[model samples]
Target: MIVRLGIAVRYDGDPLVDFTPMRFLDRFVYRNPKTSEKNARKGDKNVFRRKAYDPLGIKKLAVTSEVSALR
Candidate 1:
């Protein structure tokens, strides 16, 4: 299986001035040979930078359950 993950930023009024592009870095990749399932474990703490005016701060979308079957 192949899994694609990402993040989304939501705001009420306006976008932030110092908005940096977010990325889903697959530091480690895992796959179950028996079940043919693939996954990535990302638990880095310094994933994003938050500004004072940022309402959402830095949020990571669900990545665990976003897997696709590789057929």
Candidate 2:
């Protein structure tokens, strides 16, 4: 498994919405409950920044919109 997960999109601007992902996210991602807002914005702003790109897990990654779309 990769050390980090890159968020490919922004889930902001929703007032009344489906927050189910937040719950599921806690299972797979390491969340700082106290500073999640700031940390999420900075880290998730770049979708490819933290993706491991090698057979052994490197830094350079290749991600397409279809990748998240498939999930």
Q: The CA-based lDDT of model 2 is what?
A: 0.55
Estimate, for each residue in 1-71, the C-alpha lDDT of model 1 and write its tens digit: 12354555556543453342331222223433332122224433443555355334223333343432221
TM-score for candidate 2, residues paired by index: 0.15
Regions more than 4 Å wrong, model 1:
1-5, 16-71
Q: How many backbone clashes does candidate 1 have?
A: 0
Clashes of 2: 0
Q: Would you give me the overall lDDT of model 1?
A: 0.37
Q: Per model, state how many residue pairs clash.
A: 0, 0
